[model samples]
Target: MTFEEQPIDYSNYLPDAPQARSVAAEMVATRQSEQVKAALFSAKQFPRDQQASFNRIMQACQRKKLAEEAAYEFPKGGSKVTGPSIRLAEVLAQNWGNMEYGVVELDQVNGVSKMEAYAWDIETNTRRSMIFNVTHERKAKGRINKLDDPRDIYELTANMGARRVRACILGVIPGDIVDAALDRCRQTLKDGYTEPLTDRLRKALLKFQEKYGVSKEMIEEYVGCGQDAFTENDFLKIAGVWRSLSDNMAKREDYFNITKVHVPSNAEEEFLKLQEVEKKEDVVHDISTE
Candidate 1:
């Protein structure tokens, strides 16, 4: 029997080596270059109609559901942070025409994820990209816990990537277009829904209470008016606050004064009862001894 020595492929172990990394990088670069060329050719052949694009964006924003989710609000430094939401940005990017945008998780190493989000305008050859890192950690009850579970890491990465992707898309799209879409969304929300205004308001009250322990009274107080007097603008603001909470962007306490009253569990109740009995006995003993 004879043994033959085989050459080692260092590329397998050393990804940073020129032979390994450069080849892969070149392949990716070539593919992306072809895509860009194709997009530019298509754009030249069929240019975007600005008015049509504007109308499409406005029409999408006019929908009640889209309008409801068009913007988000979060509290920061004793002030409110409000802006167009990722959902709205997606709609804008899609309707804006001749634009391409997406987010990609490039790599993960040492409990951190490297991600890239980009938006490119094929017609004007305008491009925007954002590279960001997401740390695999979860904060709960004022404590930071490192995430070991793949599902948790993936979800956290996705949520953070969405905001970056939104930023890139918005960067490529015109500011005026985004503004017009937001305005349309506002008007759509203000116009009220097919359901009666009272019914919708009641549902919103129930939703907030069930989801966030926010009572109708708290909501009224926040808006400085009762539900009956709640204006369209007030409802929009409430929706924004809800978006902030749903996305975990802010806590309920940030926007509302949530007074926590500890309810006794069975164990706690028994402990309290035992304490009361002990106190009674001590009181009786003190009186007799005196």
Candidate 2:
């Protein structure tokens, strides 16, 4: 009996195909039980459903958490352009499998150089693309790696496009508890029903670590709201004190001291002392400006 002719597999032909990679990238092959335990203990107030999602997100963060996974500061206009823009190549390389596939291409049309990049995420099946104007309207001639060769432009845009893909997969780039909190704060601000630190105003507060100084014990001791019920405005005095700070002023310990005492009570003496100090400083400022 003649065997039927076997059909060509064509399946392994496209190595660049997104479907070729494991649908679920292998997570870190370890469990941070202690971290999870601590988080769960602190998050007992979260509803059962959310705790599960939090657990998954936290674990992914730990796995992808590179030592240098730092946030990119938005550069100010007129800042020196000493080098190419910040690139997250290392971050994407470390988490390459997290991405399904990506494409980078460059073109020049009528003297304008354009670069485009696209990154795909299987988890969300989202496509993130970035387009950059390399020369805009400049002579488009005799520029460094970017305007001349343009490969660098494609790669640079690809790096940013990868970050967007990672965000789709992880729900946030630089995935960590800090970013998680910021996302929540942003959502709360969008809702506008609660919280003094609307997303925009939060940048004016002290640096990230000092923005909310109340220790866990202080929250438990002084706060009436349970953990899950707690919102940014819950620290009424803390929010109020920082709200009064001049623009971009570094936070001072004077405000954090409020955490040492119960809220709204037993804190009057300290509050008065702070008010007196402010008045004296204001008087000194008036004399100095003369």
Candidate 3:
């Protein structure tokens, strides 16, 4: 047949010709299966040593920064509730060995996203998984606002997923180890404040004011003590509150009872300026002015 008379084979273009979707799915399943098999074989070959893992976790918790961020304290029902933070949980899982942990977004529909947080003990074949739904909205100041931006939705989902992932890891890990890590973190925080107390207090006050719009007066009201009366224990509690606030583990209202922040008057501003000058003069050496 001449080239002009060649037949057009429409089979390739037919609706069901290649089954592309099924083929792709099969490939994905096969790859996932291979990964699982490899993970299991490797875990079997090299198992985790419990004592070594414990030491590693405790050592990791000894770092001042990690220990500082290790736990958050929040008030509930007229009592304080404290627990290991997500950062600490993640450290534990990493050192625990032969573990798989992650959060995955399975689907999003109708302003709600479905996600799964999972942790697996590869050597022991123990697994914990939690599936939950996150609504793409946030309640703030008695207002319910819907999130429409992609970035906002992603951040909301990730934040929610992180808490769930933390819980899953905690579920699989031993309780005693987590408790020990918390204790170590507490000691680290207690001893980590090597700077001058005045300097630490200044920085903390500035931070709380700048970050949360909380004034020194508000803090005094909350703690029932003025700045001069503040002790090392008070500073530690403030640090815990800061960590809790930074991680979104608790709200300002939960810790402070301030409904309206008072604006300083002109006289108060002048007093603060005088206080600052005196504070600076206290550190400055007396040099004779000729």
Candidate 4:
């Protein structure tokens, strides 16, 4: 089964979370326990400026005997949020309006349990979504029958949506799933790929990528390749590459490692910035071991 993006109708942007929230509350809680909180904090998942406010809220929670709640939230504009995904959504909504969220499967074919998640990026000012055509069937544990499991598509949707938002929208993770997706895009675009170096074509290509929020370095690399006219296949290859990287799948440097994907030497600056950011996230705002 192949996953293709389906056009979203504006009339179908309903997001039903309350029912799922109640059903999976216990499981979600277990997955987000104090231990998990401590570990994530140690991993420096939260932003730095929020660190002081987070500590203050936690201290206040301790005084008020609400440490349990504190583990799930930080003081935010005199309110609170629990999960990272919800916080990210709120951040996007605040920074960029016209935000829409939805999850649905059009037709179930091949036992795929396919669902598409939609997200909007502030920088891009456009709709972004990821659809998976893969199957997710886990083995039952402890003599439990698969049908007896209550963690159904709702749990999967929530989990997958959160993860996609993190990796695609926020650009936090540079993992295998994203890497494979980029590689696939590269492969798809490499057919009859040629660089056109004409003035009009160069400007047009640059404009196309800018509209889609592609990095300047990436566009420059591709535009410098050919001095002739562009072709339909050329458009497909270029669009495929831009759309793939526009989701911010892998860091700029990863393209160098990606065979058939060319990266100019100057693009190393973006990779260096990504490395520095990751290092800071690895060490900063770690939860105290004591």
Tens digits of per-residue lDDT, candidate 3, 93-127, equal 99999999999999999999999999999999989
Tens-digit lDDT string for candidate 1 (88-150): 999998988899888889998999999998898889989999899999998899999999999
- How many Å off is the CA of 152 in candidate 3? 2.8
Runs in model 3 deviating more than 4 A are 1-18, 139-143, 209-221, 224-231, 259-290
Clashes of 1: 0
| Model 4 C-alpha lDDT per residue in residues 48-106, reported as the tens digit of each score | 33344333322332222221111122223534222323333333333332234556664
State in Å the error of residue 15, model 2: 28
CA RMSD per model (angstroms): 8.4, 20.5, 6.2, 27.2
Of the two candidates 2 and 3, the one with more favorable TM-score, higher being better, is 3
Off by over 4 Å in 2: 1-67, 74-103, 109-113, 121-125, 136-178, 181-290
The order of the candidates by lDDT, greatest first, is 3, 1, 4, 2
Worst 10 residues of 2 by lDDT: 78-87
In order, how many clashes per candidate?
0, 0, 0, 2
Clashing pairs in 3: none
**TM-score of each candidate?**
0.76, 0.27, 0.79, 0.26
